[model samples]
Target: MRFPCPDLDPPYYAVIFTSRRTPGDGGYDAMGERMEALAREQPGYLGIESVRAADGHGITVSYWRDLESIRAWRQHEEHRAAQARGRADWYEAYEVRVCRVEREHGFDRQRA
Candidate 1:
């Protein structure tokens, strides 16, 4: 399901994390849920959406108010540990991109 987010104006930040997973779960699912819960408790957090394919390819996009919030999340102790675990066992490969969202437009049939 597409996660709903509050309507935010221009100039926010988005972190797009794309990854290819390893063979099995390796505790990744639990850790991911924990991390998402933690992120929601943090300052400047906006929203997030995630999807995974049967082939173990996935993408998670998280929105933030600013870069400093992203840095803080990166430095969080539990998140650091999860990162280490991901590097060692969970993900085969991953890429992270941070972008400034200058503009956005979408259509929702329900809204219409």
Candidate 2:
């Protein structure tokens, strides 16, 4: 798998998002792509990884530099709009959890 961000050390933050997608797109795909692009421009965005199962359950983990960055992203007008759209149309159910990374370890086989 390709990693979105490389060389990230400890003491970062991650927003863990898990959700069940609704039956139809309802503009979700467009908005999701837009959000990814917009997020990449944000001040503290590190990277994001996301995947959806054939059954429609999905998980997205977004890395950030700090809690302040997360808060700013949550309060961003466009992001807020997306949240409303998610509640009103796109998701069957969803949950978000934020956690701090105190330590991490990984190796890339391709690099090896």
Per-prediction TM-score, please? 0.94, 0.93
Residue pairs in candidate 1 whose N, alpha carbon or C atoms collide under 3 angstroms: none
Local distance difference test scores for all models: 0.92, 0.91
The most accurate candidate by TM-score is 1
**Tens digits of lDDT, candidate 1, 1-112:** 3466667787899999999999988788889899999999999999998999999999999999999999999999999999999999999999999999999988778898
Model 2 agreement with the true structure over 1-112: per-residue lDDT tens digits: 2245677778999999999998988798899999999999999999998888888899999999999999999999999999999999999999999999999887888888
Query: Which stretches in model 1 have alpha-carbon errors above 4 Å?
Result: 1-4
CA RMSD of each candidate after superposition: 1.2, 1.5
Q: Which regions in candidate 2 have their CA more than 4 angstroms from the true location?
A: 1-4
